[model samples]
Target: MDALIEKLKGQIIEQLNLVEVKPADIKPDAPLFGEGLGLDSIDALELIVLLEKHYGIKIQNPADGKKIFESVRTMAEFIKSNGKD
Candidate 1:
């Protein structure tokens, strides 16, 4: 799933328009929201849509989303384990 992490990192950075931050800069354990990346609700929505669009997986509930989106590692695992692609 290393390739999936790389791709997700790239997508996150790209979709969020995070200037000056490369995909390599993001740590797998670093939280994507709150104090870690300072991302907000909108960013979370973007990420959810991104996952669905790219991985063919639909996050039906926001509660589950929080668990799956805890970090880069979590997101990659979530997508890989739950994604249809």
Candidate 2:
């Protein structure tokens, strides 16, 4: 799980082109949006693409995106639950 979380931080930074962010700067349990990373809807869309492109895990229900993208830990857990990690 820790490995997955670390890998995800790298992916998120790279995919979002967050030049100012580093993998070490992200807290696994920190929220990915709002007061956390300050991500918006567009960043959410990019995250969706990131999941599918990297893990082959697709978000079948758009509503689930809220729960799934809550944080790096959540995303890693989701991938593990789906056997994608």
Candidate 3:
């Protein structure tokens, strides 16, 4: 789980082109939107693509995205449950 979290941080930074952010900057349990990472809807779309492209995981429901993308930890958890490690 720790390895997955670490890999997720790197993938998110690279996929989103977040050059100013590093893996350490992303707290696993911190919210990824609004007050946390300050990500918006566009970033959400990129995240979906990131999941599919990297993890071969497709989000079956759009509503679940709110929960799945709640934080880095949540994303990792979702991937672990629905896709590869």
- The top-ranked prediction according to lDDT is 2
Model 3 is weakest, by summed lDDT over 10 consecutive residues, at: 31-40
Q: Residue 72's C-alpha lDDT in candidate 2?
A: 96
- lDDT-better candidate, 1 vs 3: 3
Structural similarity to truth (TM-score) of each candidate? 0.89, 0.95, 0.93
Itemize residue pairs with steric clashes in candidate 3.
Answer: none
List model 2 lDDT by residue over 1-85, tens digit each.
Answer: 9999999999999999888988988999888988856788899999999999999988877778999999999999999999998
Residue-level lDDT tens digits of model 3 in 1-85? 9999999999999988888998999999988987856678889989999999999998778778999999999999998898588
Worst 10 residues of 2 by lDDT: 31-40
- Distance (Å) between predicted and true CA of 72, model 1? 0.7
- After superposition, candidate 1 runs with Cα above 4 Å error: 83-85
Could you tell me the lDDT of residue 40 within candidate 1? 92
Backbone clash pairs in model 1 (N, Cα, C under 3 Å; residues 3+ apart or in different chains), count: 0
In candidate 1, position 75 carries an lDDT of: 93
Off by over 4 Å in 3: none
Question: How would you encode candidate 1's per-residue C-alpha lDDT over 1-85 as one tens digit per residue?
Answer: 7888888898888888888888878998888878857789989888888887888787788778788889989999987677443
